[model samples]
Target: MDTHPLFIIIDDVHPILITELEKSGITCHYHPQITRNELLTIIHQYTGLVVRSKTPIDRELIDAASNLKIIGRYGAGMENIDTDYAESKGIVCLNAPEGNRNAVAEHTIGLLFALLNKICIANHQIKNGIWDRNNNWGQEITGKTIGIIGYGNTGSTFAKKLQGFDVTLLAYDKYKSGFGNEFVRETDMETIFAEADILSLHIPLTTETNNLVNRNFIEQFQKPFILLNTSRGQIVNTSDLVAAI
Candidate 1:
């Protein structure tokens, strides 16, 4: 009998996590680009499996992993992992969103500032020797009603970060209640649709969120809204967003 604790790995995970796993006395196999079809063939031999967002961990994959006890996700968003099927099969699913949240938040803020200040255009135009200061104008975020679609970890952090700017913040999440604060106003979708100058999407993609933003969704707004989507790409309708902006 093979007594070694075998882990069917994905890519390189955090050294700390790897050290801890090795400390527990487990032998690991690294497969940086293991396809779903390939995983199915050898999954029955593995007890622990680690993956990122390369492939979907659906019911078929779960059934293939008869000996799989735990699945570890390297990054944020477990939309790639089929939690329902995994849970039904008594397999634990976990992810590391904490490692990447700060980076995502910082990038979002940087992009917001650049988009709001026209910094990218300024830099590009100045490099081309066309510095017309009067023609180049920028808008301030102050007093602008900014609507946040989801008030989870990232959304709440962004709202708190933007509070010093004095921008009116509105947050709406149907599943949650009482996320309001002195800096943020908790409201419904209707109020957000009518009031927000810039709308930021921080919602997770799921069965209900395959195409959350569409023609009817945008038509609710009476203003030309600046939409920021640093979360999930599919949450915002790419074609409709392009046309609206």
Candidate 2:
């Protein structure tokens, strides 16, 4: 069997992966606390690099990785890795979003429900002995218009989770077409902004999507809507969101 060296950085991935890699003659090293400078100093020794967003594999790091043939990201999103540059250098960039897509989708719904029902707020108040039911009146999920931006794995899974909710689902993916199903209505941004009562973001962080949800984007909505983000934090400008809220 051919031997391949792999360096693991900042991932709590299951042990099975390491076992499988070793079975395939791949040397695995788990180093969760490796700094960027240390990675640059020793990256050239490995053929594969496994990371989970703690270190940015920039051009300088890539240049330092003389033997790197592949970059395996533990989860979705390759923004932390300079994919274009790596690809230009013939390095294969890989990620496993399917591993946790369901978890993310389900968590998104959990958060949405929590916000609508004021679960966190109520829990805090109840624990403090303030029984204020009137101030905690909740909103209903049924019959609400939900606009989902970026209808990819998490987005479609979220729509699936809303199957029995009786809410109108609107999905807009700028880079996708013909992906809508019975649970989701493929629509334009204008329609989503004009009609949605709830907005959920599931887009990745990229040059085009960074700070995509800004003041102007929020103001485009015809009515005030509850915002839910289960994607990269950078996608929504925090200051802009604060102002909008």
Candidate 3:
């Protein structure tokens, strides 16, 4: 009997993870550009799988993975995998949200800062040899209310990053309770809608989240808010988001 575990990575991942797996005596195969049909043909050989957003592990692919014991997603999102069906077949699916939470939090803060300061607009204007400072006065982040939807790894990391800033933080997660800390106040959606000057989404893509943000959702906000969505693109209807702006 072959006791060595075989793991196939169908997407690009950090070298450290692959190195660590190799050190553990697991045979690792890195195939960043593996096609769907190619993957189906070679699926039965691996005991474990590593993936990112490049491949969709649908029911057909899962059915072909006869020896697949586990599937590891490099980042937070696992919408590409058929988790329910995989689990039903006793295949454990996992994700590394904690690994990139800080990076996501920092990048989100940077984007929010750039938007609030009119940095992008100013940069474009400057590049075109136009400088009108008074007309492009930017908003200050201090004293602003930031409402975070989905107080998970990324959300909590963002709240922690905002601790130094003089801003009010509110977090709401339907699946959670008592998640509030010194940096965030646990609140309901209605309160967030009424008081948030900015809203940030950090939820995963699921059946309940498909087109979660729409025209009606935007209209409920008491004031026009700077919306930030670092989650899946499908979570917000692009047309509705454009109209909201």
Candidate 4:
């Protein structure tokens, strides 16, 4: 068994995952929860690090990790990881999306349905003893155009999950092309805004994508559209969403 301690920092990981990794003969320094100051203090000691969304992995942490070999992410989206610097120093950064692909995809669809149906509003009204069923009739997702902004693992999974819904799934990936899948019909932003009735954002938040959903895009949308932003909060501008919603 490999007994050498692979000094590590795993944030936002469940207890079960730590136990499994430890059982595999790798010694893990489990700081299950930590603050920035505490992290800076303890991070230099670890050679391996695992992370989720709770902590930000910046250049300071990477520079301090002299013995660091790899950084493992429990979910998809390596947006927080400093990939260019890691590659410059030969550190392996990995994300395990295969574990929760179906979960995120299902959750996205569920959120869309809830939004369109006003599920929370319906539940609240019923509890308050208001029983006008006609007032709460919801819009159907069938045959509507859905614009999917990103086409990564989650985006692709979301596309596959939408097959049964019978809606037109139009997708655009900034870095990807030739998305000729049967489940999703590939298109450009102009076409999406002109035609989509429901726009589901699946893009990552980077400098380019920050506030990608802005007033301009909102104004361009020809339909009284429903928006979905389960991927990243910043991808959809908070101010724009507030204004539109």
User: TM-score for all predictions?
Assistant: 0.90, 0.95, 0.97, 0.89
How much lDDT does candidate 2 score?
0.90
What is the lDDT, from 0 to 100, of the residue 113 in candidate 2?
A: 94
Mark the regions of model 4 whose C-alpha exceeds 4 Å error after superposition.
1-5, 19-25
lDDT of 4 by residue, 1-245 (tens): 55465856557567787788788766888776677778788777677888887777888878877778888987877788887898678788888866776888899899888878888789999999988789788889898888888887788889898999888989988889998588788889899889998887776678888888889879998888888887777787789779887
Q: Which ranges in model 2 have alpha carbons more than 4 Å from their true place?
A: 5-10
lDDT of 1 by residue, 103-201 (tens): 776778888888888899999999999887876688888889999988887888888888789899999997898989899999999999999998888
Candidate 3 at residue 24, lDDT?
Answer: 91
Q: On TM-score, who's better, 1 or 4?
A: 1
Q: Give the Å shift of residue 45 in candidate 3.
A: 1.0
Q: For residues 154-236, could you state the per-residue lDDT of candidate 3 as single tens digits? A: 99999999999999999999999998878799999999999999999999999999999998898999998998899998999
Model 1: pairs clashing at backbone N, Cα or C within 3 Å: none
Model 2: weakest 10-residue lDDT segment is: 1-10
Clash counts per candidate, in order, are 0, 0, 0, 0
C-alpha positional error of residue 229 in candidate 1 after TM-score superposition, expressed in Å: 0.6
Sorted on lDDT, best first, the list reads 3, 2, 1, 4
Error of 3 at 218 (Å): 0.3
